[model samples]
Target chain A: MYKNILLAADGSNNALRAANEAIKIASLSNESVIDIVYVADYEKTKEDVLHASSADELMIERRKKIQNVEKALKDNNVSYKVTILHGLPGPEIIKYANERKMDIVVIGSRGLNSLQEMVIGSVSHKVMKRVYCPVLIVK
Target chain B: MQSLKQQWFGNVRGDILSGIVVALALIPEAIAFSIIAGVDPMVGLYASFCVAVIIAFVGGRPGMISAATGAMALLMVPLVRDHGVEYLLAATILTGIIQILFGIFKVAKIMKFIPNAVMIGFVNALAILIFMAQVPHFIGISNMTYVFVAITLVIVYTLPRFVKAIPAPLVALVILTAVAMFSGFELRTIGDLGNITQSLPSFLIPNVPFNFETLQIILPYSLALAIVGLLESLLTAQIVDDMTGTASNKNKEARGQGIANVVTGFFGGMAACAMIGQSVINIKSGGRGRLSSLVAGSFLMFLIIVLGDLVVKIPMSVLVGIMIMVSIGTFDWSSFKYLAKAPRTDAIVMLATVIIVVYTHDLSIGVLAGVLLSAIFFVVKISTLKVERKNSHYIVKGQLFFASTDGFIDYFKSTDINEKEITIDFSNSRIWDDSGVAALSKVKDMLRDEGIEAKVIGLDTSSQKVVQQLDGISSSH
Candidate 1:
């Protein structure tokens, strides 16, 4: 049923699972295009920039995570485009999805552990609450 | 050494100008604080001069000003009221000794434990306390005094918008003081508050008797002063460090403050600490070196010696107006706007801290209460951890720290499966500390006693390493 699928990846096993699910769903349609997005959270990056000596090191670390998702998509032979955005993950993802008129958003249930997710609510939960399109949160 | 000299004198002209600006701002504040502590205005002035000069050389953070602050002044009131300036001097000495000990013990590292909520609460509480201190001058004062205060406030707030080069408070003080003098009103000038000794501060040991009784009297106040002084100083240093994009030696700062206070006490100055408002003013005015602070101290003394008569004639209402502006500027208004949207626990902690601080007039107690409450809330939240049971597997999510260990074990204990092989998945959870390892051991022991086979699985590399080091197991199911 989905045409433009947005897969939000953070390189976690859960995010990989969501990526796999998105790839499977997209395989059924010939015209469907998948966009794998990774949000380098602005606040987290700012904190890392402050605490870490080198900004390049933090950027490299984030690049590694994005590369992992890219490699997974390449290995699966999925035809997809990857975009990395810098901002809060939830709002940025939702905004991008709405602006791009995404048919469905596939995301991991949690990127950080449950305790942190409980304390600062999971990005997926926020995206699910606010996104206009259908959301498939992979556990 | 050459690099150090270059660094120190990098911005000589800018530092000198900023130092002069900071010095001018420091005068009325120092005098007002001395009055607040129930001592001669010279005592506060001398303390400001001594601490500023000393900290300029030895303070951990460069580009930050250290001087007599309202927080330290508030603390000295009870001390000066109960046992006179002699005993207060003794307490000041003792406070310095304790702060030195704190530095040697590396107590500044504990500052990281203080939550953002508590810090915000502290800033707001101090602002409220400062504003309240000015209330007496407004209430029951003469009509002309009221008019002068209004004009002073007006000048303080509006003058800055028009002219950024001149410090608004100094202008307001000068204008209002001249107006009060010309109008021939029976107003309460700085002279009315306390005598301003024209002579420079002299070195003298405190004359309090050194005995057990004296120690008992001064110990509590000294401890309070030492802690409050260090807290404010170190916090202000952190703020300046952030503003300047530089790291400060917090331990060194603590020790420097201790040394400054000790020297201040010996020189007949009341206890002093870092003033955040003045530090910001210094930085905003382009101060970037120790020379700025040194010049600030030297210029303050120069003003006291040369313009002592003019300083004495400044109206108390003008200082009150400046302080009110300081109080308003110090408060974090963002906390109020964010209260509804912030996490409930954080909001409660901040509010509780503000209320307790305002009511008790004790910043330390309020912060302590907030930290205690935050810890309790953390435990309560973590204790709600649950384990989901499936066929031959149990999924453990949430934190596996000390607070949630008992709850985690209890969940597995209630299960009546006997002699069954079970796998526990921990991919969704994390082991924060050694307590988590102990919890895993306890669970394994309990499961062994019930004749059940337990396999722990899905540990991340770090958690796996910790488990391997403790339990001597490498592979998980």
Candidate 2:
């Protein structure tokens, strides 16, 4: 029943699982288009960016992950467009999804334990709480 | 030197005003710290003056203030009590020597390894210590002391809400001191704690006989003083750098502190270091140059010389109130809320550091414990890293560092393999150091020993370069 699907990938295995789930959902509908997004997660990577000698170096590293995600989507024959955003992952993903009016969001759970997930507040949990659309969190 | 002059002389008015404010704050604090160290109040005052003046000229951090601190005071109680002031002076000079060596060795660079949790813990511990130090004055003293302390706290906390022009603590200290003088209560004053010298401090070498026996007596205390002094000074500089959005020359600051201590010792003063409370007060009062520190020292000497009688009469409870306010202001209260939100390991580290520091009254041990625990937790976390094997190809993900080397090898050993050739992909991971390269070598040797040909692929340029360097050297064998 999903028409517009937003898949958030971080190049991790969990994210790859979510991408697969999004592919399956898109394949079920003829008019479905998957918008794949990769958030650079500034809060998590700010130190790396600051320590790196040049912005070009960081961009090149990120491009490799994006290329891998693109290859995966192409191999699955999923009609998709790719976009990269820089900011906190959860809020940025939710904002993009809301602005694009995506019908569903597929995200990966980092599989933190209950205590850790409650304390640190996993990105998926934040997205699930705030996103307007239904969230499919792949563990 | 030209740039140094500019840095020192720039914003002269702000510096002078801030210096005067800091000097005022320093008087009661210096006297109080001297009492804690079991030395005459003049010793702490002279040390405050000498350290302030010398550090102003040579310190790495221009806008920061350094003076006689509670941390250094607490460390000196035994030395002053046993060997007397003469030996304490010798220890102070030696402490300066050791700190100079630390600067020469660039030990200030080690500040990077101190994690955020440890810093928060240090601040909290210091806050608790400062508060606890005031408890003696709170109990068994005149009931008037409590009233004055409450009045001072109210003025310190509420005055800023109405007027932002003056520092609230200074206003509170001045107003409360005057009130206590007029109220004519049987209040303990700075003079009640220790004698205050009105004459200028003169330079003289410590009178202790220089011998192996003397060295043995002073060395341990001197070492403790040196390390604790530098730790407090460097951490204060870091905090000020964050406050003023400027970087400090940590090595220079270390050397400056060393020189200040040596000079203070020669002038019959106790050991001195950075005071975070006074530095915050200076910053909040518009101090922004080396001149402010210069003024703080010169003005303090002037105050003691010219206004010694008036200063001695200021109630101890007034100082107690200001310190209590400092304790309240210095504490990272948000950490309580953060404890529930932060990772359990981090919370544990912070809590453990705070507890140990409070119990042992040793800042270094607490921080060391926190750093050690953080290292252990890091090792545990990285060891959980996994490598997935699929159809003669292995995908390694997660950080590969010294902590994870053995785990990486074990993961390779446990996987069932029958293929003649295998490719290992490292597209999703980073090899952090030489240990990682060594681990890869062991993995290849293990597979070779099993008669399976193995090759690593998908390494990023940096990792590829490391592997190439190692492989080039090994293939020649």
Per-candidate DockQ values are 0.03, 0.03
Q: Write down the lDDT of every candidate, Cα atoms only.
A: 0.82, 0.82
| Tens digits of lDDT, candidate 2, B246-347 | 667889999999999999899998889987778867776778789999999999999899988877787888888887876776677778876898789989
Model 2 chain B, poorest ten-residue lDDT window?
B468-477
Estimated TM-score for each candidate? 0.73, 0.70
> After TM-score superposition, what is the CA distance of residue B407 in candidate 2 from its true location, in Å?
2.1
Q: Quick one: best lDDT, which candidate?
A: 1
RMSD (Cα, Å) of model 2 = 12.4
**Cα misplacement distance, residue B326 of candidate 1 (Å):** 0.9
Which docking category, incorrect, acceptable, medium or high, applies to candidate 1? incorrect
Q: Which candidate leads in TM-score?
A: 1
Stretches of model 1 off by over 4 angstroms after superposition: A1-139, B379-384, B389-393, B413-422, B430-455, B460-477
